[model samples]
Target: MKRKKILFFIYTMGKGGAARTLLNVMNNLDRNKFEPMLVTLNHDGEYEQYVNEDVQFIKLEAKRLRSGILPLAKIIRKEKVDIVFSTIPNYNMVAILAKMLSFTRAKVVVREADHVGGSLLGNLKCLVYGRFYNRTDQVISLSEGVKQNLVEKYKLKPNAIEVVYNPLDIENIKQQIEIGELSKEVAPIFNQNEKVIVTAGRLVKQKDHDTLIKAFAETNEQVKSQLVILGEGPLEEELKSLAQKLNVEDRVHFIGFQDNPYIFFHEADLFVLTSIHEGFSHVIAEALASGTPVVSTNCKSGPSEVLANGEYGDLCPVGDPKSISEAMTETLTLPPEALQMRVSKGEERAQFFNANKIVSRYGQVILNTFKK
Candidate 1:
């Protein structure tokens, strides 16, 4: 029996959530059923080492998304790809155009990893999104909230969208935590007796680290805790300045990016995410898998769904430092047993997004697309 050929196209295999999620799906895909091909404009990335040997890796000659359209279309036709899977809006557009121009029998499946709030994009860009998104054989959303946004904000057909949460390697996270130790540089930060609050993401405006820093200041005044931020981005200096301005610089530690964040998650007392929006927050689920309590801005899409209306963890309004501060303080000061109960239940919730299960769902969606 011939396995279905799938071309997993993305901008780059960088250390981003979209890339990590795609890597999980690719690495975990059943070899007996699917032939996975990872295609990217650039071959060098943080995740290049993790690609499975059975999977074919292709790097395009073109470096930019626009320049790669014709080359991608040529590869799709030449490789006779059964299905083209791409994520992120720009990559999705490129994939759809490639499939359409390739004139092959390949089906196109685009995954949207961010909420498409109506006001976020310009009218022209929104029109383009609607056109290309509707042209695909199927659309995969990282969360139900993202699906709703695509349908309502972008006018995508509700039936065309399938919600598949980002796949998590729960067992791998456990192993990393079990075997990993705190590095000498960060070891001193964790040596203290104070409760540690951790938030990991690129230091970008989307993460709203400013709000998180302000909230941490408030929480610090009420409770003895340290803020440890993992991941590097352009906003590092600005965030650090804010921390200093708030007089929390001594307690706020920007540890930059980590090869294995799961270990930090396991060691931290609490995890917090203050993203302005997300299709699905991978860090929140990772925190849960590591048995760390979460305090997230009730951002559009992921946090509320994962937290189950604040049942498993605390949820606060987006951009509200006071609410986030209060939530952080409350969670930190919870009784030991109550905190353990939430952590235990959160671990169970994380299981729902295990790699095997979520990747199977994606495989089924690809099969259904082929049948169509």
Candidate 2:
């Protein structure tokens, strides 16, 4: 059998969840059956170190997507790539356009990384995706929620989409936790007997950190606890201001991004996600793998799916501070045996997203596309 030359294209090798998921997929692909290559619009990103040495890495040297389309097309034609797999909306569109312009017979598979019902701009982009996505061979959704949104909102054919949960390297995360060192600034936050609540993600509107702060403040005042947010973004100051206004600033610790967040997850009494939306939260799975029980807003997707409707963790209404606060307090106050049972269930659920299984699902998708 001829080894299929699969080209995984992305805008960059950034540290975003989608980028990390793709890197894991590429690294775990069966090299014996498929020849994997990576193409980045720009060569620079924090995740550059994670790329496997065996995979052929190409940089278009173009700073933007518009400038890289021609270069992308040229590479597709020159390499005669068998499959062009791209993630996120912009790169997916670029991959389809490049393949069309280059007139390559390669299968173009695009992955949707977020829920589509967020803003006006997002809805408009959904329309554009609906129009152009038909040209691609397959559409991979990070969750069934995202897949249904594409089909119902965009009127896409259901058969064209596949739900492949993001891959998590549980072993790799565990290893990192073993070798991971805690930051000096965040070290003291966990030292006390107070319940420690942690959340990890970029500080942005999408993450809804404001809601998290408000909810943390609403938690039982007598219940001593600390809220540690492990990420940095444009809204850092805004979130800090919200924490101050709520009078929980002293208890809210904004420990900026850490390379190894698994350590914090391992130590946390509870992990929470107050995001307004998500396709599939890698952090939720990571937290679960670290044996931390979670509390997440029942966003458009992901949390409910990963938690299996509250079997593994608790879910609250999206953007509702009261609901989130109640869930957090309930989770925190649970009997020690009850919390441990939930944590054990979460650990079992996390294995469903093991890198090997998810990568094999991706491999099967690529192979099926090639067969067609």
Candidate 3:
């Protein structure tokens, strides 16, 4: 049997959720049955070290999307790639166009990474999807909500879209958490006996760190807890200003980005996500796997599904600081035994997205696509 060549394409290799999820899938692909290769707009990224040495890596030197079309097409034809699995709307559009320009027989599978109609860029992508998305061989969505948006809002055939959740490397996360140690910069913050609450993501509007700060401020002053936000973004100064305005700056610690965030999740009394929207949250799964109870907004697509409608964690209304504050306080105030039960439930739920299982699903999709 001839092994299929699977090419994973993305805009960057940066420390974003989409990039990390792609790396997880690429690293776990069945090497015996498939040849995995990576193509990035630029070769540089924090995740470059995580790529499996067995896989071939290509960098299109183009700084902009328009310049990469011809290069992408050329590589597709030259490699005789069996399938081009692309993520993010911009790259997905380019992938389909490249497949057409190259006239390659390889199937182009585009994965949608976020909720449609969630933002201006998202709405614009919906417009593009209506026009060029069906031209691709398959469309993969990270959550059922995302798939429904593609079918209902974008008017794509429901049968043509597949829902594949992000794969979480549970064992790897556990191992990393075990070996990871807190940085000296954050040591003073965690040294105290106060209860700790944590959230990790890029500090952007999408993350809604302002709401998180407000919610933290609303919590009882007697609760003696600290909020630690991991990851960095453009909203750093604004979030800090908001924290100061709310008089919680001393308790709300912005620790920037960390390569291994599982340790913080493991050590925290609670993990929360205040995102306004999400396709699927890998951090939620990571936190659950670390046995940390979570409190997240009932965002568009992911939190409700990942939390199983509040079975595994607390879910509050999006952007409601008061509800978030109450949920956080409730979780933090739960008895030790009750909290352990929630943590155990979370651990069981986390297994559903284990890397082995999710990767096998992708393998089946690849095989079925070729058979067709």
lDDT (Cα atoms) of all candidates against the true structure: 0.90, 0.89, 0.89
Runs off by more than 4 Å, candidate 2: 118-121
Question: What tens digits encode model 1's per-residue C-alpha lDDT throughout 185-250?
Answer: 898888898989999999999899999999999999999889999999999999889999999999
Q: In candidate 1, list every pair of residues with a backbone clash.
A: 231-256
| lDDT score at residue 325, model 3, on the 0-100 scale | 93
Worst 10 residues of 2 by lDDT: 116-125
- True lDDT of residue 302, candidate 2: 89
Specify the highest-lDDT model's number. Answer: 1
The TM-score measured for candidate 2 stands at 0.96
lDDT tens readout by residue for model 2, 1-372: 788899999988876897898899999999878999999987687788879999999999898998888999999999999899999888888999999888878899899888865478767778888888888888898999999999976668999999999999999999988998777877888898799999999998999998888888988484789999988899999888888888888999988877788999999999999998998888999999999999999998989999998888889998999989988998899998988888899999999999999999999987898666
Residue-wise lDDT of candidate 3 within 1-372, one digit each (tens)? 789999888888897998899999999988888999998886479888888899899999897887888999999999999999988888888888888888879998889888868567767768777678888888888899888888866788999888999999999999999999998988777789888999999988888988988999888474788999999899899989998888888999988788889999998899999999999988999999998999999998899889888888889999999999999998889998988888899999999999999998988887788766
TM-score of each: 0.97, 0.96, 0.97
Deviation in Å, model 1, residue 119 alpha carbon: 2.6
By lDDT, the candidates rank as: 1, 2, 3
**For each predicted model, how many residue pairs clash, with residues at least 3 apart or on different chains?**
1, 0, 1
